[model samples]
Target: MKVLIADDHGIIRLGVSQIIKEIDPGSTIHEAEDFDETIRLLNAHIIDLLILDINIPGGNNFQMISTVKSKQPDIKVLVFSAFSEELYATRYFKAGADGYLQKDTSPVEVKSAVNTILSGKHYMSQNIREYFLQGMIRKEVNMNNPLAELSDRETEVARMLVMGISQTAIAEKLNLHTSTVGTHKYRIFEKLAVSNIAELIEKYRIYDYS
Candidate 1:
């Protein structure tokens, strides 16, 4: 089997490569330190599986899944992220991930998830499964999700804020006035009912979904 490990951290790539080797001693493993490199490698190799990080450099969004699938429709993708499953796993699944595993997962479960996806099955934790069931039962928008209240632009600004980007920097990146970015930040905090970036991040982890 051929696998691509796409993450910015050298340590994480090394560790997961070791686990993949243990899972299949003859498996061919390739590593990418960023999303651009990942796409380049994908174009250069017939990868069977891609282990992806959500926050890899050059992209930190679900569209990355679409891009990957567009490049190689048959490749199975496993989202390996440090983000909370409740906030991100279902979204990744909806965006076309074969599986979602937290970075803190044990080596045994990592192997299990990888093997399961390799066999062409979806994988999710028991808790995520239960959450899906509960969501289906409710069958409604979660009104408590404050992040959902933000507009697309506001959400973009909020994410940058949570990432520690300055308002000026965000304005420059988004091509908006600094005052407009500050206004968006103020509105985001207000909508999320948070007083500061720390609170916004905490609320984000609790309520943010795709």
Candidate 2:
């Protein structure tokens, strides 16, 4: 099996790579620390499965799913993120991820999730399944997550802004005008219902930007 693990954390890459080896000793594994590198590796290799961190640099939005599918429509993607399942799993599933695995899940679950996807099936934990169902039965489930309102670019800008990057720097980094960054910042705050950076940080505590 050919597998690519894309995460900015070296430790996460190392640990997941070890898990992949344990799952299949002969598997070819590739690692990338950012979305651009992830895309490059995807283009350069026939990756059977991708273990992706949604918050990796340049991957702060659900649009990443389509981007990956555009490159390799047949490649399976398992989203490995620290975000709450109730809030993000179904959203990613709708975005075309083959599976959703929380970062804090046990190695056994990780192995199971990976193995299931490799077997040409979707994988979602019981908890995620229940959350998905609840969302279906009661539409308010998804509506309650305030962060869901941000668009792709707004999400990227919000994360950078919360990380203490000034609007000008964010513009330079993302190649947008400073005023555009400010607009995104304004919209992010408005959508997330936070008036300041501290509230924004608290709102995104699940992201653990520490």
Q: Please, what is the whole-model Cα lDDT of each candidate in the order they appear?
A: 0.85, 0.85
Best candidate according to TM-score: 2
Cα distance off (Å), candidate 1, residue 165: 2.0
Task: Give the lDDT of residue 41 in candidate 2.
Answer: 96
How does residue 112 of candidate 1 score in lDDT? 93
What shift in Å separates residue 130 of candidate 1 from its native position after superposition?
A: 1.5
C-alpha RMSD of each candidate structure in angstroms: 3.7, 3.0
Q: Which residue runs of candidate 1 sit more than 4 Å off their true CA positions?
A: 136-145, 148-157, 166-187, 195-210
Model 2 pairs in collision: none
**Per-prediction TM-score:** 0.80, 0.82
